[model samples]
Target: MPLTFHWFLPTNGDSRDVVGGGHGSPATVSGRDRPPTVAYLSQIARAAEDLGFVGALTPTGAWCEDAWLTTAMVSQNTQRLKFLVAFRPGFVSPTLAAQMASTFQRQSGGRLLLNVVTGGESQEQRAYGDFLDKDDRYRRTGEFLQVVRGLWEGQTVDLVGEHLQIEGAKLARVPDPVPEVYFGGSSPIAGKIAARHADVYLTWGEPPAAVAEKIARIRGLAEKDGRSVRFGIRLHVITRDTSEQAWAEARRLLDGFDPETVRAVQAGLARSESEGQRRMLALHGGGSDALEIHPNLWAGIGLVRGGAGTALVGSHEEVAERIADYHRLGIDEFVLSGYPHLEEAYWFGEGVLPRLRTQGLWQHPFDTRTPPSAQVPFAGAATAR
Candidate 1:
């Protein structure tokens, strides 16, 4: 299968410097001056659409804007691009979530994909009125997906699971094309949920070997459930015309980091109960040095950012090669973002995607209708201010 690429909508904000306040942080912080306006997010959506990316992932959390509402408004701005809306299963009732997804699909013309984020941090989840521990949250997510899946399948679900009890729940009109579920977790309970329910198992950008090990783990678990799941990696990218330019850009972003801010964010994230977040912290150890953990993979983002801290930093060709390496390791989808998302979208879209297309690794999702020449260029595309 040709690799599917998705860009991220920085609902928190975008900046030339790495943004802070992700999963376990105090608040959404874009250290740079830019604010996350609807107009700005729409520009990103349009850019990702024009660049042949299949969708844009809108995150959900206290740190960022609401994914469901943000994506709904953004979806109105783009015709073909999908929105992988990140939502927590425990925050909202499963029936309502299913109905909202159905409404979103109908309104957006089937442009809804679900990213089920079972809240990882107990303190953060408590702020949203959820007191479940990490393990119980995963259990709730498993039950939540089951109910939501049943509703989407046109069943009158009356599941009385330990975490969820939906009585005679049924959607008035089922979603025409059921949205695919994208989920990620590193804990044992998380693996079970992904194995049983996820259409795509997502992971933060890890080295190829680590990614392969994760894929093998999920594949084995899913096989036991008599199911199959695709794999995806969420990453930041710093692709440029040359390797020197890309690394230079990476260094510039690194240089912008305030040492005190790094220490503060790292200290806060160290309290995270999430295994995935712990792993991300381990990759960089909240330091500004030795960011290039692998040949083209940079772990500088995690210095402040919470979720996906690693980036693929290299020339266009080198970035494409790393993507191919991940593809060979069974990563079918790539959910990518970068600092100052709009410009980075152009850099990767114009410089790197073309190379992937030429290498037979990717094709524009709407290539049959929109020709390459007619497509908008990311560099000069109007981000209507």
Candidate 2:
């Protein structure tokens, strides 16, 4: 199968500077020129759809808008672009979540994908009235998926588990085509559950060697469970027409950050219980200097943002090469985004995607959504009179 690519919807907010808030960190107030509004998010969804992204990942957490509501409204503006809705399992009942997924699938023409995020921070959990520790939260997620999966398969689920209890719960309309589960976690318990359930296992963008190790470890667990799953990497992307332009953009974003903001965000992120977050911290070492964690990969985003903090930074061709390298190492899917989403979408969509097409690695999954020869209207398309 051709490799798949997904983009992100910055649900918290968007800015020229990196907007920060996640993994137990407080939402830092910046001059967010683009609020995460329905209209702005719809623009991004339509742009990603036109760019040929398979789907767009909307995050779940206290810091951001509700993923379900945002995606449902945006889905109307899009034709075939799927919504990879990320939601914590323990917060919602399994039966309700299953039924909601069925409704979303039926309404959106089966364009619904699920990203199960097991909450990692105890304080963040307690903010929503959840007191479960890190380990217990994973345990609850395992139980949660079991029940949701059973219901989606048209099975009458009767579960009296310690975390969840559902009696004779079944989806009246099972998703005609069930949404693929995309899951990510770095902990041992998280891996066990992902191996048992996820259709596509996701990891944060780490170095090639570390990523290979994660793929192998997940493959081993999946094999023991008689299952096989695809792997995906979630990262941000910064591509430009030339290497100089790309590096300049990266440096601009880096320079926008004040020392105080970087220090505060890094301090908060250091307390994150998510192993992936820890690995991200390791890459940048919470220092103001030395960002390229790997070739064409920049860790400067982690200085403020939570979750997927790294980004692929280089010229369009180099970005495509880095992506191709990851594909060779067992990553068939990539979920990416950038600082100011709209402009960067065009950069990657036009600059990198065409190269991938020539290499036979990608085809816009939804070419029918736009005019066959539609092109982005770059500012430089015309010179001043």
Candidate 3:
């Protein structure tokens, strides 16, 4: 299948300088400037749409602006782009969640895609007065999805699971096209939940080998359930006109990181019980050195970002090569973002995507009318004898 690409909205604020605070971290002052205004986020969304991205992921957490609201407002600005709204299942009742999704789908013309984030950090959950531990939270997510799925299917749900008790929960109007559930977790329980529930299983930007291993693990569990699920990988991307320009940009982003801030953030991330967060910390060891863990794959983002700490950094061709490598390993969807979201969208959209199209690996999801070869520069090259 042709690959699908998605961009990210830095609703947490963005700048040329590194913007900190993600996952468990409190919104830290980078001492840099940039506010996450709706206008700015809409700009990024519009750019992604123009660039042929299928969707834009609005992250959910205490560190960023609310994903639901941000995406809802931003959706009004773009015509063909979907919003992969990241939201925790535990924070809201399943029935209401279904209603919100239905309403969003109607309002946005089926442009809503949900990313189910089972809260990973206890401290952050507690801040919201949710005291469930990691395992219990996963249980809640399972129950939550059960009820929400039933409601979305136009059934009156009366589910009495261990973590949820919904009596007669139903949506008066079912969503015409039920939103696809995008989920990620590294724990054993997480794998089980994903196999049982997810339409698309998501993972952070791990190396190709690691991603393949994870895919195998998920496949094993999914086979037991007799169901198949697609896979997606999320990462930051830094593409430029040339490989040298890309690496220089990567180095500049690394240069701005304060060692003390790295230590402080790593310490906080280290306390996280999330296996995914732990894996991210191990990638770069919270250091500024040796960030190129693999060719065109930089671990520098791990120095401060909690989730998806690595990035695909290189020229458009190199970035396309790495993406194809992942695609070969069974990644059909990519959720990519970069520092200063708007500009990076242009870089990746104009740069790597054309190359992927030339290789016959990708086609725009929203532009079914436009023939692929017509839109892609190297399409004729691909067909040449």
For every model shown, the clashing-pair count is 0, 0, 0
Q: Point out where model 2 deviates above 4 Å.
A: 368-385
Total clashes in model 3, counting residue pairs 3 or more apart in sequence or in different chains: 0
* C-alpha lDDT of residue 19 in model 1: 82
| 4-116: candidate 2 lDDT, tens digit per residue | 98888988889887887755667455647899999999899888888888899998888889999999999987777899999999788999999999999999999999999
Per-residue error for 337 in candidate 2, Å, reads: 0.3
TM per model?
Answer: 0.96, 0.95, 0.94
Clashing residue pairs in candidate 2 are: none
Candidate 1 structure, TM-score to reference: 0.96
Any runs in candidate 3 off by more than 4 Å, and if so which?
29-32, 368-385
Best lDDT among the predictions, by candidate number:
1
Distance from true location, Cα of 201 in model 2, Å: 0.8
Model 2: per-residue Cα lDDT at residue 32: 76
lDDT of 1 at 189: 92
Candidate 1 C-alpha RMSD relative to the actual structure: 3.5
Error of 2 at 278 (Å): 0.7
Model 3 weakest lDDT span, ten residues long:
368-377
